[model samples]
Target: MTETRRSEIPPTTDPRPDQQSPAASFPSADGLRFRPLAAADVEAWLELVVRIAAFEKAPWHAQRSELEAAFSDAVNPVAENSVAGVDADGGLRAFGRVVKNPGGDKAYVLGGVDPAWQRHGVGSAVLAWQEARAAERFAADGQPGARARNYVEEDNPALRALLAGAGYSVVRYFSEMLRPLVDVTAVPVPAGISIVPWTAELSEAVRLAHNEAFADHWGSEPRTAEQWAVQMTHEHLRLDLSTVAIDEAGGDVAGYQLATVDPDVEARHGRREGYTELLGVRRAWRGRGIAPAILTDAMVRFAAAGLDHAALDVDTENPSGALGLYERMGYRAQRRSMAWDKPL
Candidate 1:
């Protein structure tokens, strides 16, 4: 649920195609070289991410294909919006990327340095480059009230300190929750509602319903068709395990639950987990038990598929009382992360 969507900014008269790469102006890092990342660097980037995850005791890691797909993204193509710091031996030591939301109101700074390279100013250099890139994008769009954002694990004091020093303040907190699949219970669909298996034909409908359901959530923006297509076709997405709830009379989508299972994460952790990547109930459909019914359906399907657990992330202060609902449904908080922001 914490996943974000980026959209193409409005065309600018000054394309600045020949402008220098942000990496070219990055702060100096001893014995390191900086450059924009490319498709060829996906493998090294995945390795770097895995190393950082292990060092930080993080529960998740990225797949190589995900990194490759990031390079192809039109909104923030790696060749243009990414910077990689490499050691003398050409090993990736640090990296940064800036992804702007569809409305140009917020840009996310995503990257980290290898633990071995920490305290050597590599992180600061990468952060500086990312912030500069975010500012440049905001200026090009000429939007007011734009800001740069970053999410850090609650346990990561170093990165939190870095952001604080750079004038960013913590704005929100999110919790990663996990529910075991043992003794799962089924919840009947509320009267006049039908829960159906997710189908390719219903993808667009689900996306629209999603946008509407999240319209009032903090920091949410509508996902364009292009952005929704990318998520719908992602390698880990499991339509077979996903479900959609429809209003019996109107036949409109009332709620949905999109599922995913990352084989790489399963292999690394030695357990199968069905991730509820996105779940929501339309505003008008709230308080009808649709959310829990869909969640129970997913847990039933996940258990039937031999998955060990179900997982999801929710904003700590979700207006819909999502955290309370999850807690009541047997989910326990496994980890926490903080969102930090700085006005552009």
Candidate 2:
């Protein structure tokens, strides 16, 4: 993700009928109304998301369950941290949300205008609401050096220009890498380590290991137990295809490769693809080839499960040299995305 700087801004309250509307700032919005999204809007939200995904050719789209989970997130409740734009008929036209990280140093801005509503000033209004809300969150938390961040696909020049105009700058680049699940090779597990299938009992241990493993990575924060629990039970997670490496002597998690399969993606792409959602090895076990071993094991299992490809995203400047490692393992960058940040 690219980082950008932001100037101080006034805080805004949640957009409700009785309060100042986010769309009111954009006179050209043509009577669009704004308010916090509620549970009843889930289906409409998914429809809007799918439309945006197709228009942008995004790598993935949100599933209904994912949206439900987001609404239930304790740190970023949908009804409080989200804004949705609707027309006279109450159809969702645009949406935005600010999600504060557990570490309180970053608030992720996510949302987009529907393809049908582009260029009518809706995008700008949505972004304005998101930035103001993110700033409000930062002020409330009293965190030093906090910033608002957004990710945009490299192919999306319109959004990139909008972010730039809003004072956001690209701070980092990420690649979505893909490798065919053919002729997968097995890498030897490190000595004194055992590759085991992911289990319900090992979920917490792996989550703890993951937090430590990524502590030094850019923009990463430890996942709270609640957040980890949500991820562990996500509808797309494929337990049978995931693997965790255990230290034989300590009986602790050394590393893990969590895999997932998005049925929607498979249907749209016409190929079953396995996504390596999270892969990490604890710092103490870094140089023992544990990462590669578990990754190889996951790939082999994916192929055995009849998957056509394996994919994962990696930060281009990862502290752990992850980009080079994935390259060596036969993955190629399919596309790039930028992370933009604005200081709060």
Candidate 3:
């Protein structure tokens, strides 16, 4: 079967026993096989991840090197879990990951399946493997089952249905919203606040600022400079687009906003897309309208980049009513992702 022909792919779901059995042929003759991926599968995995994201119209831009960095980190997590699904051909076909929630013991993560392999047990298989891995880890260390969870944008019924059938239930939802650059005007920083270019010299400050801002947000975790460095290695990174708000008086990172654009992605997405990857204000700086101020700065940066819109994601259950804050800034929900979890 050709890569584009999914008609021969397995059924929408397959319940693999808790353990694998010996079979020369696939359990179901749909020409699908499930196995773990190795370092050699990096390039294939990258292609599949991009294809799957495009299929769902999700926003992401990553190169091969970025995938490698992420996979390397997977073996050693800064704060997340991951899994992969390989076919009989020994090629990667699907992937999923769960991030450790700093606020709780759960993993809130994201996943995707190759379109051509949809309903072929690729996504289901990947998730099942992830669950088993978690289970084994617990068995070895004697820790409680770390509940594995994720979210699906409400509009993605296909993904929602698949996950639900696999024993994952929606526990929370969030919207990914965007604001037109034209609707924003750059405003001067308030007293005690200043904007500066994010650079290697200021890496420590940037890390501290983000850690502080996300401290109380959902899925909070202890992030170190190493984690930040791994993220920086992402092929999609553009330091110029990432900006930080500094408190010159205290010489501390009070607030920050990181943004990036990809020409390759622009070609695929039609219009250039910019991400509000990270936006945060220190606890002490909260309620001072600092987040909005930093947002305005981000809009200014986006507009200057000749982009028309900028996007950011938020958990609907944030303690600070962050969704309301985004709405006040003119962001409307573009997509709602749902989360599903099963005992590991």
State how far residue 333 of model 3 sits from its true place (Å): 1.9
TM-score of each: 0.90, 0.90, 0.80
In the range 193-230, model 1's lDDT, one tens digit per residue, is: 99999998888999899889887788776777766766
Number of colliding residue pairs in each model = 0, 10, 10
Model 2, C-alpha of 49: deviation from truth (Å): 0.6
lDDT of 3 by residue, 3-77 (tens): 000000111111212322212221221555544345666788778877876777665534676556554443224
Per-candidate local distance difference test: 0.80, 0.78, 0.61
TM-score (C-alpha, index-matched) for candidate 1: 0.90
Residue 285, candidate 2: C-alpha displacement in angstroms: 0.9
Could you say which candidate leads in lDDT?
1
User: On residues 1-344, what C-alpha lDDT tens digit does candidate 2 reach at each position?
Assistant: 11111100112222223221222232226768888888999999999999999998877766676677776665566766788889999999988887775445778888889998898888888887777777666665666676888888899988999999999999988888889888678899889999999999999888788778877778776666666766666678899999889999989898888888887767677778898888888888888998888888988898888888998888898878888998998999988888899986
Off by over 4 Å in 3: 1-30, 61-63, 74-91, 95-104, 107-112
Clashes of 2: 10
Instruction: Please tell me which model should have the higher lDDT, number 1 or number 3.
Output: 1
